[model samples]
Target: MNGCCYGRPTRLPWGVSFPPSSFAGLEFGNAKIHPSQLYFSLAGLVVFAFVWAVRKRTGPAGTLFWISTMLYALVRIPLDFTRAYEPETAFLSAFGIEIVESQLSSLAIALFSLLMIMRLRRESLAPSAA
Candidate 1:
């Protein structure tokens, strides 16, 4: 499952072959692919650590949520390129760059998070009516 869930199958560069039972779902004929799930897990840990580290320094409540959302999108947009995904019928393309469904969703989430962060920040800064 995890192996097949993400990333395209990669062929061995030096013509290396493994027994089909060697890695179970990790092998395809004579090639091993990028462990995209592991990559994603590692990236998630990194994001968590970074956000946790900065939590105390970040101003206002909910800032970390927005920051983390943006961070995930930033990493995922590039990371998804390494994975194999079905061609989207409703994707956006421009200047030779295509945005797939997952990427588009990430973008929307990040943008919405940013807007909410800004709104919250503005609210936090405004003088309170005693």
Candidate 2:
């Protein structure tokens, strides 16, 4: 998908050009668009670096996984805004906030992972039952 941004010309790997009418009213017309795939790839590398760096310092057994998951979602939530996507057709769209399906899924995953991390931390810190 193409995102609107003013920059140097983008070279599509497919080596094909679309006419102005090719894209359903998007009007790309050989215009440069944000390289969303590259951005996502870079974000993934960054997330991996951060998670790997802190792996040994996590609070509990499952905390690292949850932390990494939440971190990825946090990154994805903002990253999705940079990409062109269909807005969710729900009641929230009525409020004028354009949220995509990926963003919604990321938000849910982030929240759930956070809750799990907190629960794991609490369990790790509680008195031992043994």
Best by TM-score, which number?
1
Tens-digit lDDT track of model 2 for 53-99: 99899888989889889988999888765555433433246455677
lDDT of 1 by residue, 40-128 (tens): 88889999999999999877898999889888887887777656555573387788666788888888888898898898899899999
Clash totals for all candidate models: 0, 0
Give the residue spans of candidate 2 off by over 4 A.
1-27, 87-97
User: In candidate 2, residue 31 scores what lDDT?
Assistant: 67
Can you list the residue pairs that collide in candidate 2?
Answer: none
TM-score of each: 0.75, 0.73
In model 2, the Cα lDDT at residue 94 comes to 43
Q: Which candidate leads in lDDT?
A: 1
* TM-score (C-alpha) between model 2 and the true structure: 0.73
